[model samples]
Target: MAAKEKLSGNIIQRSAIFLENIGKRFAAGIEELGYVMVLFVECVYWVLTGFRRKQPVRVAAVFKEVREIGVNALLIVSVLCLAVGVMLSIQGIATLKQFGQELWVVDLVAQSVTREFAPLIVGILVAGRSGSAITARIGTMNESQELDALRVIGINPVRHLAAPVLVGMMISVPLLTIVGDFMGIMGSALFTGTEIDMPLDVYIQRTFEALKPDDIHQGLIKASVFAIIIALVGVSNGFQVGSGAEGVGRSTTRSVVLSISCIVVADMIFTYFLNIGTLT
Candidate 1:
């Protein structure tokens, strides 16, 4: 009887501890999300009033970030998008040729690239590249107490650090998506014409004809939202940085992982709503 009671008590204690840990983790996750929301709202406020407020946005900072997030990222985005385009065309042609609809590859590539792949791929790439950089940069600053110095010097860190990045990402992501869209279409056209033995002009015309403005605008909108997610998540992780070089590294990794996760989830939500009526 004593042995049985002891075993039952041990099981109960372990279960209680497990539940306690689960609750703590759940609470922590909720707190993190709430903090990100607060940061986002602060960013929006700064956007609306930073120029009129004590801290006008630094044009140099915004321009510098634009060069970093947008210009520097162009080549990799172009190359990867081009490869995706070619691969998509090959798959599209292989499937469509069965029904004597090989030319439909143009439609497939254009719509798929513009409405989905371009925005998603670029957003993810930015999340990996720019998002991680945002976290690391800010995290390093925080570790060095530079952010505190800014605060003491009468500059809002959100306006000075995070908001410029917010603006930069918003500008950069949509532009990259546009470039990705163009590159992807051109990529498909380059390979498909030779593979299908079709003229380049005809392929180009078919692509324009198949793609609607709505298809393209949907992607741009998605890119804009993805930019917001990446910037806010990165900034939040930076502000959350703990005390060491290890902390900075950990926060940077978290920023990339969380930014990518949020981007994908936002993409799904955007795709569903933007194409709800078209679902069959």
Candidate 2:
């Protein structure tokens, strides 16, 4: 009976050790991911320096990715924005109507959508849609020896692949954010007139009056940062992929997760900094 008890204790100790090791492994993986992101950003910075010379930027490729990612994503953005806007209007009207201030619905809807929901939701959607696609495309190319072929031909993979994607995302995301804000407002207006007693003109006037240029600019800025995060994370995951189908799948998953995490963190940081900047 003593031996059995001792054996059980040892088993528990071993299991604890195994779990600790697993935790360490996860921490290491996360640290490696952070390092990879830093390196990728550094590389992009240097590539942009070369683009300043007016030769390294691939206009055609950047345009192509922009159209594919931004244009293709419009339907989803519009639908989601409209749905959220309608929901926001319903909730805001319900709460504010009690105060006899249903007019405030416009301000609430506009500010919330432009300053918060539009950028964050669009960022998440872009990360999920375009980010995974970027990872898979680059990973498949790497696995197919295409990247190596580019290298052999004396072309820089970072410039050819990463640059265009990063540039495209940077351009596309801000535009999408603006579109989302508009769609959200439209939806909110629809809800206001149909469901609530608020006049459309009053809602529009309130929205325009409540929204400052800084609000719109801040939203675009957040979207831009999120765009960079998504592109960088996606490309880094692609570059890190090993040689197999499983590797592509893993990279795709990592890209989406990392991009979304970065977007959230960056958005928080941007908001804090913007407030600080305004205060000062």
By TM-score, who's the top model here? 1
In lDDT terms, which candidate is top?
Answer: 1
Q: Cα-based RMSD of the predictions, in order?
A: 1.4, 2.9
**Positional deviation of 168 in candidate 1, in angstroms?**
0.6
lDDT (0-100) at residue 2 of candidate 1? 100
Each prediction's TM-score against the native? 0.96, 0.87
lDDT of the structure predicted as candidate 1:
0.93
- Candidate 2 per-residue C-alpha lDDT over 124-148 given as tens digits, one digit per residue, 9 for 90 to 100: 9999999999999999999999999
Q: What C-alpha lDDT, on a 0 to 100 scale, does residue 44 get in candidate 1?
A: 80
Global lDDT of each candidate = 0.93, 0.89
Task: Summing lDDT over every window of 10 consecutive residues in candidate 1, give the lowest-scoring window.
Answer: 50-59
